[model samples]
Structures are given as C-alpha cells and as structure tokens.
Target: MIHTRALTKDFTVGRGEAVHAVRGVSIDIEPGELVAVLGPNGAGKTTLMRMLTTLISPTSGEATVAGHDIATHPARVRRRIGYVGQGNGAGHTQRVHDELYTQGEIYGLDRRAARTRADELIEALDLGALRERKVSDLSGGQRRRLDVALGLVHAPPLLFLDEPSTGLDPQNRANLWEHILRLRERHGMTVVLTTHYLDEADTMAERVVIVDHGRVIADDTAEALKTKLAGDRLTVGSPDVRTLSRLAEALPGARDLASSGERLELRVSDAPTAAAELLFAARDAGVPVTAVQSHRPTLDDVFLTLTGRSLREESSEVSK
Candidate 1:
C-alpha cells in the first residue's frame, strides 16, 4: 500500500528557472491492487515513481510506503518494495544466476539462502537455459525478466515497474504480463506500474491514473474512464471540405471534426442518432460519401478527448 499528500518535486535549472517535475500529486493505493500510471515522456510519472521508491526526496509533502514514512523510514520502505527501473541493473560481466545471487546477498541473505533464492528465481523466470550466460549476451526481453526476478527474489510486498515492457516484442510483452498477474493473484503483491501502452493498462490495471504536465488529469478504473467517453464515432469520406463541414454541423453531439483529402472524422456523443442524421444530410446535400463507419470509444479516444492530443503523438513529441 502507498499514500501521498501534496507531493511535489522541484529542481532549479540554470538562471533560477525551476523545473517542477512532480507538482502536488496525492494518491492512495490499496494492497493487492494493480495501479497503472499513464503518461507521456516528461509528464512526471517517472519522477513520482522515483519519489515513492525513496530514490529521491520530495521538495514538499509527505509519503508513506507500506505504512513506513518515506522521509523518516526510507530503509524500511526500500525493504518492503521491489523496484524495477527502466535501466538494466545487472552488470554486463555477471552471469544471470550470479546477478540474482548478488542481489539476494545485498538484501542480507546468507550464502545458502542467496543461492537457493537465485536458483528459485532462475527457474521461476524461465532463465535456466541462460543461467550461465553473461548479462551482456542476453536479449532485451531476457534482461528485463532477469531484472524483475532480481527485484522479486526477496519477495517484497510491493513492486514498482517503470515501463517494464520497453524494447520487448509482442510475445515477450505477453509473457511478462502473465508473470505480473501471477505475482498479484498468487502472491497478493501490490503493483504500481507506469507505461505508455494503453492496452497494458486496460488489461492489467484495476485502476488507472493519467498524468500530464506534472498534474493528475484523470484517475478511475479503465472501464469507468472509457464509459465516461461512451458513445459512437462516425467517419465519413468526402472530397469537398464544405460538405464535410456541413455534415459535421448537421450531426448532433459532434464536438470535434477533422477533414483530410476526401475523409472526415467526427467525435459524436451519440452514435446511432448521429449516424442517421449524417446519412440523411449527406443524401440531401448530394455529396458522394464513400464510406461510413461507427465505432465505440476507446482508451485512445478518451485520452484524446481529455488532452486534445493522442498519447502516441504526445510521446513522440516528448522524445524529440
């Protein structure tokens, strides 16, 4: 479990300009819950995670992890939470098994206990074939799994994952999801993960928090957020821009409309009613509509409606 109140982090850049990475974020995560923090790069999700894991101190506010005060009992919080960051923690020269054994020892396990945990994690993470291989020789996905294993060898009650699926292919991503679900269902571990993938959050997280510009934009169950954007979308293709505008105005509950060369997209609050009206208006206007399709709102749609930009677009912009 985790709790934070008015958590804020600030850094002074050159010339006294302050970079507020995390600003006044307050959240409470219950035990055995999977919470996903969704955000674009530079949106402060990683900053918040780092503060919660005791990697960095907040400029002002209070936080507790697993009932231990982050500022007063950082060591206790660290012992109770396992953190798998974006970067690989294993040394290139170390073997896979040796890496985990070292982690166990650092956690205060004796030689026998460390070796036992190392072997157990190696088997559980399906790294038996590569146990003798050096970390540098492993693929990206393998290294990521090894990182997760190292974080879990001590069996912490809480886990923090920062983009755990980065650089992994579809198959490996699915495999990682299975491992994460097992940790929650079998071990009752509490998980807080930050990812750019909406599908991952939609599938794995019991609750979702969307952050942007150092602020919490939305927080709710994935289903509830999608329901908030409930409705139908109508897309029509027409060569004439004026005709597209006319159709958009004729459709009720249409908030946003986009026109491309012979294509028009509309965000409608009511799909069935708007669809019928759009067809009739097009027929009356004598504009040749090539195709018409209606679809339910998705997480992407909700994100766009809330932020005025797509999540992928925001991510690409941030990377630049």
Candidate 2:
C-alpha cells in the first residue's frame, strides 16, 4: 500500500554543513503485509518512515502511501494511516481513557463515537484496569499500548510504527508485539515498522528491508536474506585437538574457521553437509566428538554480510 522513488531527505543544522539522512531509498510495500525496516543508528530508517508518514517533507523524490501522494495529499494519507512514534504520544496528566477519547474526537469522531472507540480500544489493549489512571502512572509498556490505541482511533487500514518496542524489556516487547498482531488481525491492517531488534524483525515481519548510510541495501524475506545473503554456520566442539585439525583439513573450502577453546566454528555455504563430513572425518580419525551443532544465520548475520558490520554493535557504539 506504499510506493516510493528515490525518496531522499537532507538536513542542515546551525552550521552550513548538510546532513544526508535519507538517500534514494526506493521501496514498495504491499497491502496486508508486515514489513520491518532494519538498520542501525544514523542509518536513515527513521528518516524514511517520517517521509512516508508525511511528518517531514522530503528534499527529493516522491511517495504514495495508502493510495494518496504523500507530498500533495498529506492529509489524505494521514486519514488512511495510523502512526505510533518512538516517544509517548499521550499527555502525562490526561486520564488514560480520556486521552484515547480526545484523540478519537480529534480524528473527527463525535462524542459518542469517540467514547465507544476509546472503550473498545481500552478493552482490546487490556488497559481496562488502567482506564481510570493518569497517562503518567502507566508503565512503559502500558503507555506504548495506549499510543497504539491512539493511532488506531480512526481505524486506519495502514499503520506506521517507529521503534515501537525500543526501551521495553523482553517480556514487554513480546506483549506489545502480540497486541499489535492481534490488532492487525482484527482490522486487516498493513503494518510498516522500523526496528533495531534483529530477532524481532526476523521473527515477526514477513518482509525485511535493510538500510544503511541513508540507502537501501537489501530487501527480502528474513529467511531469504539469511540463507542467500548470509550463510549457515557450523560449529564443532571436541576435546581432542587432533579431531578438529583433521576435520578442518577435510573441509577444503570452509570460511571463517576459528578455534574457541575446544570448539571450531566455520561459516559455510551448507552447514548440514559440513557437519556430516566433520562427523565422519572425526570418526575416521578416532576422535570422539563431544558436541556438534549447526545454526541458521540470523538477521544480524545478513546485515553483517551486506554491510561488513554488526547492527547490534553499531547501535551499542552509538548509544555510548
């Protein structure tokens, strides 16, 4: 339900130097699709989302979101889509249900309709207990759920979420994801989100677009990006050093062969075959294998394969 061409955004701070925050990121997202934009800090993922959501004007290029031109028909685009930003959108002093009701009214609903929508969302997001509490009193996860409810007040068919679970712990992140998925199922909404969590992007999103340096680097399913862009990893750990040495020699073309204490890890094109060959070779060499495991490459591995850098490490470095 979204299309863009050479979507670029530039910024100028107090000085004269220009910052190319988003550059030529052309992408298409289909209806009823869950697509995650994966990137590290300063990677332009958020810039791209802001442009599509019409929060900021693009310096160059064009985009159509939910059947309306983002540049010319920003109001139309906003009417058809919901947006949940990284920060809390609710006012601190407003009551939880009151916040949602006011948002619904702002979206053009009458008092009765707004109240109905607010109550429905409060129940759907499991905020019944916190309905009477002030927005400031809710936990981080509760506040985020309220944000999602606010976005859906108009019942838009498309939704945009920027780092929806950024600061939440593992359990709360999962809870938010569950609510998002359920809401999509109930409304048949198309979801487009930007996230730094590699595993969440891999497991939750049907499609993944990897961005770096304000450019589109990769776009594909999580499995395709992992298997085709990256590769499977094979690791064998044995107490007998002779066994690992023999297996390493037997595998002629294995890459990234490393010794971690009693373990040997290899980045290979085909992990199962390599693991089998290692087992056979170890047997022939009279070396008993203590542990053998093969792993499918993760989304982080895909990012590393495409950009020669780790997204987790890059984000950590930027945070520091």
Candidate 3:
C-alpha cells in the first residue's frame, strides 16, 4: 500500500545550518498491515510521517502512498489516506459532531451522507456522549478521539497516526486502542502509527520499524527483533560473586555479562533452560545462589541492543 525509495528530508535553521530530519529511509508497507514506528525525540519519525502523508515536501528520493506518488499526486494521496497527527486537528470552537460533519463535506460527501458518516464515526469512536460539546470542552483523550473521527470521516483506506496516545492515561489509552483496533478490523484499513510507548508497540504492532538519527536502524516483527538482537535476560543473585562470574563466563550461549556486587546479569538465547542449568551448576559448585530469575526481552531491549542506548532513557531525555 505504500513504498519509498531513499526518501530523505532536510531543513535549514538559523545561519543556514542544515538539519537532516530523515535520511534515506526506504520501506514498504503492505495493505491491511498495522506497523508501528518507534524512536526517541528528534529521530525524524514525525518528519518521515509528514513526508509520507505529503504534508511536507521531501528534499530527495521518491515515495508513493496508497499507490499515488506523494510528490506528483499529493491531492490524490491525501484523498486516499487519513492522518491523525500528534496535536488535535479540530477547532476548539466547533462542536464535535459539527466538526466531523464539516470534514465529511469537505471530503465531498453530500449533506445526507456527511451527516450519516459523522454519526457513524461518533458512535464508533465513543464520542456520542460528547457530540454536542465544544471541542475545547472535551478532555485530551476525548479530543484525540474526535481527531481520529475527523480523519476517518472520508473512510480512507489508509490511516496515519502520529503519537495518537502519547499523553493519555492507561485507561484512556486502552480505550483509544480498542476503538482503533475495532475500526481497523471492521474496515481492514492499513494503519501506520508512531508512538513512544514501547509496550504498546511490542504488543500491538504486527511489525515494528525503529528509527534513529533520521535513519531506519531496524525493521521486523517484535518477536523476531527481540530474539535476534536482544535475546532474554537472566539475573542471578549469589553470595559468591566470583564463582557465579566464572560459571556465567563458561556458559556457552551467555553474552553481555555484568556483575554488580551480589547480582550477576547476562543475555542468553534461551533464558528458561539456561536459568535451570545455571542454578544446578551453582548448587554443584557451592556458589550459594540467593535468587535466579529470567525475563523476556522487550522492544526497548531490542532498541538498546541495536543502538547501545536505552530507548526509555532517550525518550525521557527528549521529554526533558
């Protein structure tokens, strides 16, 4: 449904110092796929999405969104895709239902169809109770839902969501995702979303694309990336740190070993089996292990493994 070849975008600030926001990003997204784009702040995630949505012109390369050239057929691309950006797109003074209906009309829907579609989306996104409320009066989560409804008023085949759930609480986030997943399932729409929530990307996305320094660093299913890049983590606590370290060093599949006082941590391809064997070895060697635990790798682990920086830490730094 979308294809790009070496798509890049550069911007100039004061003194004409160029900022490379997106660099040679080439990726293909198939129809009916839900892909999550993850990165830290200033990682060109928004820049890439803007280019794909034709909201901004790229400095170099080519991209086709929804089968229309983003540069040559921007209007056609806009007509076939819906974009819900990070900020609220609805006007504060407008009522929720009115704004949605107006957007439908702007998309060329007739009066009756526009009203019908507006009502449908209002119900679909759980905005029925707030239909008569002004956009400014709604809470952040409510406003985001209205934005999504406006984007889908035209029933476009593809949807682009840039940090749609960035500021919502856990309940609101779950609610938004429920509505989004339901809408996608009902319409079989292709969804490309960028988010800071690692757990969301790990659990929700069929595929993940990791961006850093305006480049595509990794792309694969969440499980595949975690297995190939991060593996599982094993934390062992022992009074005999030296003995535990020696045993960990001798393990065949262990790597990235670290010792912190009584705690020893390492990455292994199979943590469950490795943990059992390590415990047995510690007992036989009189290492006096105090505790042993295995943890599955998360998306953040994969990002850290690839970039040598924790994604969570990067996100926190960006927020600051």
Per candidate, the number of residue pairs that clash is: 0, 0, 0
Residue pair clashes in candidate 1: none
- Model 1, residue 260: distance off in Å is 4.5
TM-score (C-alpha) between model 3 and the true structure: 0.98
Predicted candidate 2 versus true structure: per-residue lDDT over 1-320, tens digit per residue: 99999999999977878999999878889899999999998899888999899999999999999999999999999889999998999999999999999999889999999999999999999999999999989999999999999999998999999999998989999999999999899889999999998989999999999999999899999988887887888878888765576567667457767777888887877888888888888888788888889999998888998889999898888768
The candidate scoring highest on TM-score is 3
**Model 1, poorest ten-residue lDDT window?**
226-235
Score every model by TM-score.
0.89, 0.93, 0.98
lDDT of 3 by residue, 94-134 (tens): 99999998999999999999999999999999888998999
Give per-residue CA lDDT, model 1, range 122-174, as digits (tens). Answer: 88888899999999999998999899998898898999999999779999999
Error of 1 at 95 (Å): 1.5
C-alpha RMSD by candidate, in order: 2.6, 2.0, 0.8
User: Which one wins on lDDT?
Assistant: 3
How does residue 219 of candidate 2 score in lDDT?
94
Model 2, CA-based lDDT: 0.90
Total backbone clashes of model 1? 0
